[model samples]
Target: MTKAANFIWYELMTPDPAGAASFYGAVVGWTIAAHNDAAVGGVDYRMIVRGDGGNAGGVLALGADMLAGGARPGWLGYLEVADVDAAIDAIKADGGAVQMPATDLPVGRIAMVSDPQGAHFYIMDPIPPEDAVPGEGGVFSVTEAQHVRWNELATSDPDAAIAFYKKHFGWGQEGEMDMGPLGAYRFLQRGDVMIGAVMPLMEGYPVPVWNFYLGVDDIDRARAAVTANGGTITSEPMEIPGGEYAMNAIDPQGAPIGFVGPRKS
Candidate 1:
């Protein structure tokens, strides 16, 4: 049985899909194409295409009903599991909750779930297409530009969050960085890869959530493109241990996003 280890896909839910497509096209260099779905009465869901023409994830236009349900424009990640329904059962057994029950799409079976601390993400059992490549990885890549580079989680309980994921998803705590008063920034590993880190949930985030960082060629140039395209920078570029720079920003409609790249002066 394969455990859920990687965040295989990412989706940004915004009220303005075309505008988001334009914004990311400038900032992250992703091209979007509308996915014609007969299921949701043809909802405006666009695919995020990377430079290598691989699927990064999607940009979904939030409907009025979704907005009324208090859905805001934010990015969410999807973990590929062997069985979506079984994954939900295990999540519940481990003190997690399912926001959406298991449902079958044209492509796969999926359910929305949260850890015990309430950080939400999806679990899916994908049905590969006839032309799909064997063992092909999804949206995330540690070194590829225009792909998700990191999966940072600001959880209410870092210790418990780390334990839960390790037991369920085969993740391990690899290292630690003491952030003085903000709490420990502990690294998370999936097999041999350092996928991301977990930190103490900060002051303003109402709930625990995953912040996926996309890769760019140059941090400074991407920063300028963000402001030029109507996004707001939340955190200024900060140099990390690897000598790369990372920063946080929000889309024009207020969806939080992150970027990682070289800081070229």
Candidate 2:
């Protein structure tokens, strides 16, 4: 079984997949490959491939039906689990809501869910090949410079949110940082690896949600590429504790994303 609580996949659901793909390709230097889902009787999807030919994530075009049903443009992360159905049940029992029930797909059984504080994520039990081994290919490595590097949660109740996820995914608090008025930023770990953090929503953040950061080689250049490619840089690049820098951005379609990298200077 895949390791539980490891984020195995990332996806972007957008009204303009072609445009979003183009914009991201320029900003993050990813190569987009089109994948038709006709075999699965679903809409066309895309694979965001890294330079090494490994897939970083996917781009899914939202249909009119989905938009009419209130599905907006956004990015979602899929966390691997041992049992999707059992995970869904555990989430519900912990005051969380089931957005989509566990359903079988070509890749795995998946369930869309939200925590008690409304932070959304996916629980997936991925199908394995006969010769496949656990902990291979599906997840990005911490050393990978161009894949997803960090995940941040902006929630209504950081304490409750952390507890809800910990109960289901076995996440532990590694350590925390005081953000002064924004309260404490609690870092989360899966086993020994620090996967991300959960913190109270800041003043300007719209809602409780998970924000993913894509690692880049140069924060300054990536920030420029975002605006040059019709994306908006919401926050200018700022230095973090490790001497790395990060910036927040909004794609032309309005989906929020973040970039982290080493400063060229």
What is the Å distance of residue 139 in model 1 from its true position? 0.9
- Estimate the Cα RMSD of every predicted model relative to the unseen true structure: 1.7, 2.0
Candidate 1 ranges beyond 4 A from true positions: 1-4, 34-42, 131-135
The candidate 1 region of ten consecutive residues with least summed lDDT is: 34-43
Over 4 Å off, model 2:
1-4, 130-132, 136-138
lDDT of 1: 0.88
Candidate 2 lDDT, tens digit per residue, 1-265? 2244778889888888778878888888787765545533467687788877777888878889999998888889998888777777778888888998888888788889998888788878888667666645454555456699888999999888887778777788878999898799899887888878888898777779999889888888888889998999889998876788889999999899988998886
Model 1 over residues 1-265: C-alpha lDDT tens digits? 3454777789999998878888999999998875534543456777889988988888888989999998899999988788788889899999999998998887788899999999999987877779875334568888888999999999999999999998878788989999999989999988788999999999878899999999999999999999999999999999998899999999998899999999878
Listed in order, each prediction's TM-score against the native is 0.95, 0.94
Best by TM-score: 1
Q: In terms of lDDT, which candidate is strongest?
A: 1
- Candidate 1 backbone collisions, by pair: none
TM-score of 2: 0.94
What shift in Å separates residue 73 of candidate 2 from its native position after superposition?
Answer: 1.2
Would you list the C-alpha lDDT of every candidate in the order shown? 0.88, 0.82
